[model samples]
Target: MTALNWKLVVDTRDAQTLADFWAAALEYEVEDATPLIDHLLKAGDLPEAAVAEHNGHRVFRGYAAVRHPEDPYDPFTGIGKGRRLLFQDVPEPKTVKNRLHIDIHAEPDGLETLVSRLESLGATRVNEVDKGPAGHWWVMRDPEGNEFCVA
Candidate 1:
């Protein structure tokens, strides 16, 4: 058997916005790809049209990512080598329930507080659901309407 690397890839209308949201939500760090972007552009491997300025630094227009704060990353490429979420631009909007969603676990008695914090960050509370012994959870959506749960 072979081990494999993985990271969640999400579709978004605004990569930077989504990356920022998730980075804060998960206490992750937004990967800084400015140096790589500059190098690539200078080498003519990445065209000027494929990049944009975000927070005073260059980033790939179609993609951005966040990494777990403790994870290792390639300093030159700003690529995360551990837990990560990559956001890529898509022309269409999200119009349906997500087949896959993230579940955020709160510390004991922390659910309400966490929910409020997420709301302040542009997340909407969809509803709360109770499943008997299985416990209760809140269904929420990110700014771009990606579904996730908090319990």
Candidate 2:
């Protein structure tokens, strides 16, 4: 099979809000789809109902994304081709434990500082787990309760 590009997709109550949190947390850049959104609207290829003003720019109403700051992106579409996370709005709230989660690795001796920063950004500490010889890490939840680990 040919190589495939991939991105993590997450469901959120508010795409923009979640994107904002993740962007700041990861020091990533929120994808800018304003130009494409505008062009599509003008060409009648997109409906106004599907787009809305967010952070002062047009974005898809039900979706938002963040990309690694140095990643390459399609200039006109603002779509990232490298590491990315896409958030899409969903009517249902998160009600179960995450089947999959992200693990953030901090620079040596930086875990504590990273944890503090994440807490300031609305992450809540769930608990810390220490596995003999395997190391220890902190379990935390995002603003919307999605669990992730910091090590």
Task: Quote model 1's TM-score.
Answer: 0.96
TM-score per candidate? 0.96, 0.95
Q: Which regions of candidate 2 are displaced past 4 Å? A: none
Count of clashes, each model: 0, 0
Q: Which 10 successive residues of model 1 have the least lDDT summed? A: 53-62
Q: Encode model 2's per-residue lDDT on 54-77: one tens digit a residue.
A: 889899998999999898999999
Q: For model 2, which pairs clash?
A: none
True-vs-predicted CA distance for residue 60, candidate 1, Å = 0.3
Q: Write the per-residue lDDT of candidate 1 for residues 1-151, one digit (tens) a residue.
A: 9778899999999999999999989889999999999899999999899999998879899799999989889999999999999999999988889999999998888999999999999999999999978988899999999999999
lDDT of 2: 0.94
